[model samples]
Each structure stands twice: as structure tokens, then as C-alpha cells.
Target chain A: MDDAPAYSPTPRTRATRNRDRVRYDAATVHAILDEGRLCHLGFVADGAPVVLPTLYARVGGVLYLHGSTGAAAMRAARDGGLEVCATVTLTDGLVLARSGMHHSVNYRSVVVRGTARRVSDEAEQRSALDAIVDAVVPGRSADCRPADAKELAQTAVLRLELREVSAKVRTGGVNEEPEDLDLPHWAGVVPVTETIGAPEPDAAMAPGTPLPGYLRTFTGASD
Target chain B: MDDAPAYSPTPRTRATRNRDRVRYDAATVHAILDEGRLCHLGFVADGAPVVLPTLYARVGGVLYLHGSTGAAAMRAARDGGLEVCATVTLTDGLVLARSGMHHSVNYRSVVVRGTARRVSDEAEQRSALDAIVDAVVPGRSADCRPADAKELAQTAVLRLELREVSAKVRTGGVNEEPEDLDLPHWAGVVPVTETIGAPEPDAAMAPGTPLPGYLRTFTGASD
Candidate 1:
């Protein structure tokens, strides 16, 4: 297999502190993005900062976000390309250090800085939308009804190239001061895990629609 | 019981797309913020947007963030009050609509717009540090060793009052198209739950150190 280009972080995406935690490999960045279900999208709106939690999907080297055509943020990005910073974070566990100052959380996060533009192509739009559905649950796009022409017309899709991206991760045990290590306080990690619960069927389901294989074994990206 | 002031939304915090999902009550916003363990902090640096995932705690009406005093972002915010947009999101489930266009995720999210200033008062700073610790695990600050003067001097705490904030929430079943209702496809929600697993003790833990009651019965913010 051909090697992918290294994700060189620009000034905007570079990790200013904890420089050692930064990861530049494309595979590592892609894996974290694929495992994430949501992205906190940040943009400058009306000369002030604004951050919104939204659904996103990564297809190859491009990230796609879908929303209504009339949505304010999407329209703002589509009319004139908007500079956007999107971040995805997965908290693994609470790092219980010996001292209050040393307490931290183990987490993996990725930040991407890019300009978002409208995806006007019909075929690409349909596939991008499918990629988002399948990102939520694998095999969901094929199992669900596809979007029709009218449905497609009402939705707006924005594409962001994964050029300026960086991933930062903190893992393993807690780091505490050596003097405080002997203190009479418990120091360990309490794992925070995401588990799939029993899927709830729609009340209007027609008869016995078997629970799809994917839903039965669904474990979200956090694990 | 004394009532809290309602969090009025400025143009920045308003939910422009889904106005119906916007919430103004302080209680609702505080609940969402307290239940969230992490937040995506958005700030502009050198005329570019940046978003970082970090731990935060909300005590009463003030939100505090603790980190190294020399960290670039915290220093920037401390030297001259920096405009910040902090967001916390809790994803409840994935809404699978019949059409790809309608696929959405059930989530509760809050956006706060304010200027972050250095927490100078020593007393308040100590309490803020404790709040940050207990925020991760209830009653953790009291259980852990308190920060020494040197530790306190190295740590920088920043406070942002919860003045301009708004919350947006989407719940319930999938919203499928009327025409697509007859399509033979599974449409439901796969609930996503954050659960606590068995706590792994530190390798260097002294034998016979009993796991605290709080750790034994730990339930993270998300149920």
C-alpha cells in the first residue's frame, strides 16, 4: 500500500503546549476522526466567536457536514467560504492525581482548520450524506431509505478538505508529584466508557421488524 | 428558594436554525453544563480560530478552568481578557431517519460567550481548583491531597461568568418523511450511554488501600 502524506500542522492547528502529545501521522488522525460521532465546529460569526455541536463524516481526506439549506451557519459558509475550526474529543478516563493541582483527564482530540465550501455535485452529495449515516452506525446507509430528489434539494452539504489537521492524545496512568505519591489518598483511573444500550423501536413500526445486526452490536467510537 | 437570573442569548448564542430547541432558563443550562465533564473552548489567536478540548468546572454562576500558568492560551486569556466561546455537548442517541437527508443525532449542548479573566483572589482560586477536582468525581477534592503553595503558584485559574449562554436540545424518535414512512426500512434510535467500568488501581498503589466509596459507586455525568 502507498504511504499517505504526513499531516503537517499549520500554525492554527499546532499544539502550543504538551508538544510531545501531538501526532502527525495521517492514519492516527483519520482513526480518531472516524471514531468520533460529533464535532464542535467553531467559526467567527458577526465578529464574535461561536461554537456549535454538529454531526460530521470523514470521507477519505474530506470532511462533510449536512444541514438544512436555510440553516444560518451552513448558509454563512456556503455564500462566502468561512474559516472553520472543528474539534472532536473523546474522554477516556478521569486521572485522579494525588493533588488537586495534578488532576487531569485522559483524552484524545483532533483539530482541523479549514475553509468550508458548498458541495453542489448531486452524486457526491448523495454519497456524502450516506457516509454520514454509516458513520453513525456501520451498514445504516444501505439498510435505510435513500434520499430522493426533493429531499436532496432541501439539504445543503459542506465539504472541508483535511489539509491543516492535528491530533493530540494523552493516555496511560496519572502523573503526580513524587512527594505526594506517598500521601494517604487513592490515586487511580476511573474509566469512562460509552456503551450501547437496547435500541428502542419506533412506535409506528409495522409488525416485527427484526433488530438489524448492526444495532444489536453497536459500540460507539469511544471504545 | 431564590431564583436565578435567566440566561439571555445574544446574537452569538442564539440558535438561529432551530429556535424552538433554544432554552433560556438558568436551571436547564446549568444542569447541562454540570453534567458535562469536558468542554470545547473556542478562542481566536493571531487572527485565526482555535478550539481546544479541556476540563472545566461550574461553581454557582462562575465557570473555572485550571491549567499551567505558563500555557499559551491561559496566559493570553489572563494577560488581557480574551473573548471565549465554550461549548459542552452530550449526545443521547443517533436518530436514524428513513431518508439520509433527515438523519440527525439527539444531543444537548450549551454555548457560552464571555471574556475570560484571571482568577486573582487566592481564596477563590483554591475553591475553584477544588471545584474542578470534584467536578470530575463528586467529593474528590476533599478526598485528595490539597494543593501546596508552590503547586498553587504554578497553576493558573481563569473564570468566565455565565452571562450570555443558551442551550439547544433535540430528543425523541426519528423524524422521517411522510412519503418515506411506507418504505421498508428500520428507523429508530440507538441509545448511547456513558457508563463507568471497574476502576483500575495504580500499579504502585500500597496494598490494603481500600477503594473509596465514591469510586465504588461512581456514575459519571452521563447516565
Candidate 2:
């Protein structure tokens, strides 16, 4: 938890290929995790792998996962800490190349493999819910109605400490062979960005209801 | 392989909660898969689950996964058909609700679980490579130089049959309690879209290289 210390790579977290693109620093890991509103959770179920998408938030070194209490994965984690792999990816651009073999997508991704335990502490659970909300839109939790007792009972929250993690990023322009540079194929990077459009206010709200300050400044992509 | 038949659910594939949001039809499954350029592959490695993002394409009822031959997942599948779960998710909007408990994401996602084997057929391998290129941008395979023997030899391709598959979708407006409708919160969907910016040609390319016709009409979001 020092300002920006490197997470020593575990044997499983080390990169086998693209060794240069792998980053072990905590800053890169936190930035990627914070920028994403969703993360895919992978776990073993019935002795087979199951992957599901869910909302997540990072508070300090722990990553909170939100789901219904009825969810299978949530139940499994609640019984005992469930071994899981959580991954988040943000697309940067399309890497077009002169040859089909070289085409790739420029993206930043982080994969964390460890045990995720259910948040049984009431205070920690409530705060984790708020952090999850703010993770999507900063300051959103304060604007919305807090969950009541019944609602809280129905919700399931799990936290995975960022113990074993690593990041892989691909950036820059098209990569084509020298011989294919003049192959008459246009090669370039097409910048891809996620943007939020105008908000469609709830029809039942008052006609003069103003858009919240946070909504006005909301952006789909991180700077 | 029927055009519109529903995929029968197995005990594992059946929805345990929110059954209304789960889908088993082929149409919904195909649409979600085709709209996404990247997918998360979940596989058990060294007795633990591992998740990695990679480019993918669908041909008929099979999903073609692209990765370097050196990748651990690729090597595992090539040695023998590997048990894997491949998932693709497309974020349609952000669902803002009146209470924190009701907050959710508007998305379309499909999960396919099966044993994926390394594609060894020469004809299928060549076409799968083309299909993967075209998955990012339609009609792109014909524009670039086809992979030669050396590139093909280095590339590893895996195909997972779409047998045990299911789709889960969340769409439309916020879901809040009847009592909380007047909570003064901004509750609605914030449109999210993936957009492409002007192409940045490689610096090494000729100054006057014209943008290809496909590039001129490229759009990040599928229509």
C-alpha cells in the first residue's frame, strides 16, 4: 500500500509471452481496475470453469464484487472463500496490419487470481456498495437512496484482495512487414473510444428536475 | 445448427435466478457474439482458473479463438481438447436506479462452455484466420495480405463448438421500488457507445496513401 510499489510476480502471474508489455507496478493495476465499470469473474463450478460479467470496485487492495444473493457464484463464495480469476479490459484502438496474421487490438488488461470471500462485515458491506456505485459514476452513491435493511439482506457482496495480479498492455500503431509496406494496403490505427450520450431523464421526474452535477461531468472513458 | 432453434439448457446452463433475463435462442446468442471483437476465455491451468482476453470470431456454430502459439491456454487446447468457457459481453447502457440495490448495467452477453481443440484442418484454419480479421472490421480479410506458411505455423487457433451456450441480457429503464419512485434521484439509462475516431496512418507509410474504402465507412458499433 505504499504510494506505488510493484507487486512481486507469482509464478502464475508472470508473463510467458510479450514479456515487455507485462507490468507489475500497483499504479498500472489500480488505474485499469478503476477505469472499468465491469469485470469478468471466472471460477470453478461443478469442476468446470464458469465466466460471468459483474460490477466491481476497488477500495485499497481489495476488489468488491456485486451480485444477487441467489447467484451461484455468490453462494459458493459465501460458504467459504471461492477461488476466482477476475479480469478487466479497456480497448484503446484497432491495430491494423498489412498482413492478416499481424492484426491485433490495442488494449490494457489486468488479471487477478485469488480467493474472494463474502463481505460479512455489515459496515464494510455498506461501504463496498457505495464504492461500487461511485466506481461507475463518482459521487453517485450519495445522490441515490441507500439500500434499506431488506434490500441489503438480498444483496451479496464479495471482496477479492489484489494479492496475485499482473497487467498486459498493447499500444502504438500498425505493425507490418518491411516488404509489405508498399503492398497497396492502407495500414493505420483506428482509435476506438467509449462515449456516453445525452442522458434520458426518468419521465416521472419533475419537468424542471436538473441534471446532477456528477451526471453533467460524467465520461465513459478515463483520462 | 437450425437458424432459430433454442438451445436446450443443461443443469449447468439453466438460470438459477432472474430467469426472465436468460435466453437460449440461437439468434440472441449469435447477435451478441458477433457484436463483440474480443472475448474472455476461462480455462483451468495448473489446477486453478485463468482468464484472458483474446480476439474471437464465429463461423457457423463454432467460435474461432486467435492467440499466439506460445500462450498457455493455446498450448493446453492444442495438446488435447481443453475444457474452456468463452464469454463475450457488449455494454449497451448504464442503468442508474433510485436505490443502490437496484443499480445494474444494460448489457448483452453470451457464454459458451465446451471443450475447445486446436483447429488442425488446413482449409478451416485459413478461413478461420480470415474470419477473425473480418470480425473486427467486415471485409478486412480481403484487403490485407493473407498469412503465409511461416505466419500460419506460428499462429495457434482454437475452435469451440456452440453446443452448451446461453445468453443473458439486461435492457431498458431503471428498476426501482414503487415507494422510491419519488426519491429525487436521476434514474434512467445513460447511452453508451463505442465510436471510432479518424484513422492515424503509420508514420512509415507514404504521405499520400489513401484511406481504404472500408476504412472510410468503418464504425465501431455494429448496426
Candidate of highest lDDT: 2
| Regions of candidate 1 where Cα sits further than 4 Å from its true position | A1-5, A68-72, A219-223, B67-72, B219-223
Q: Residues B18-93, candidate 1, lDDT per residue (tens digit)? A: 7888897988899899999888888876666777786789988888976542366677777888788889999998
Interface RMSD of 1: 1.6
List where candidate 2 sits over 4 angstroms from the true fold.
Answer: A68-70, A219-223, B69-71, B219-223
Tens-digit lDDT track of model 1 for A9-78: 7766666678888897888888898999788888776666777776789998899976542366677776
The native-contact fractions of the candidates, in order shown, are 0.83, 0.85
Candidate 2 residues A22-122, lDDT tens each?
99899999999999988988898878898888899999888998865246677789898889999999999998899898798899999999999999888
TM-score of each: 0.93, 0.96
lDDT of 2 at A2: 32
Worst 10 residues of 1 chain A by lDDT: A214-223
Model 2, range B1-223, lDDT digits (tens) per residue?
6395888899888888879999999989998999999999888987788888979999889899986524667777888788999989999888889888888888999999999999888789999999999999888999999989888888888999999999999988888889999888888878898988888888877897887777777843222
Worst 10 residues of 2 chain B by lDDT: B214-223
